[model samples]
Target: MKAFFSALSTLTVLPVPRRFHQCDEKSLAASVVYFPVVGLFVGVLLVGLLYFLKAIFPPLVLAAVLLFVLVMLTGALHLDGVADLADGLGAGGAPERMLAVMKESQVGAFGVIALVLVLLLKFSLFFEIIDKGRWLDFVLMTLLSRWAMALAAFLGKYPRVAGTGLAFIGKISLA
Candidate 1:
């Protein structure tokens, strides 16, 4: 239960009990298993919102609303990662320099372009999915993406000696 709440609080902007926000390293590692569950919860919300707004708004507007809801639900967590990675890679130098670039507070040109491209891609896809009435796809997409995060955590190595991601990276296992 603690692990589930930890995962939920970490992954989303949705409010959780304050106690759940303070977790031990073990609980944080255990929380990996609940990532997909959180995704499923978000997905259900998106689908429900889609159904409720489908009749009220045109397809394009409905898609934009659904995309906005999804971004808000997760608090744009993944998007930050996307922008950071883009900034790092775009710097295009030694590994150390790339890491330095990524750690900077200000976003660079690559970050802006990457964010724009990602959001545009998501909006376009949402428009198509809504037009096709494929609501369930949204659910499956969220679920699988979070599951993939768990898998990556289990398989990935933490680059820095200490950082936020260190709590999960290399700590999760298939068990």
Candidate 2:
């Protein structure tokens, strides 16, 4: 469907038809329902990659590769959000000032630190999961994270008058 294709194109670097990339606002908002489906697809790809590479590389190297592939797959969209949020929170002043800081193109110290910490945490978790041979956890992790993103969008208010999240933020419903 258009909604699923829209969600897939928006969430991942994986190629979808160009027409799918240019969706109406309704289709964009409806795409929220398919976020978890996209996540499941991504998870399956990662699991398949892990199985293929498990013997070719050690756990540590494989973990890094998996993380790299995951980042590449999503085009580091969440990581950018994390860094921007860190920069905003780290500024620590009025809401307007924090928003200004976040809107700046350049990353600050807090952004770097946050990115490092997040990547490290993910790397460690991936290492542990691979070392323990818990491959299925990848599916659960990706699925739940995407579901959480949808839930947040459903419940969250869009602070700015207009921004990237306007299409879905506070616009999604359970129905």
lDDT of each: 0.90, 0.92
lDDT of 1 by residue, 1-175 (tens): 8788999998998889977655778889999999999989889999998888888999999888988888888899989889999999999999999999999989999999999999999999999998998889999999999999999999999888888888899998775
Across 8-107, the per-residue lDDT of candidate 2 in tens digits comes to: 9889987898766556778789999899999999999999999999889999999999999999999999899899999999999999999989989999
Evaluated against the true structure, the overall lDDT of model 1 is: 0.90
Candidate topping lDDT = 2
TM-score: which candidate is best?
2
Candidate 1's C-alpha runs over 4 A off are: none
Worst 10 residues of 2 by lDDT: 18-27
* lDDT comparing candidate 2 with the true structure: 0.92
Cα deviation in Å at residue 41, candidate 1?
A: 0.5
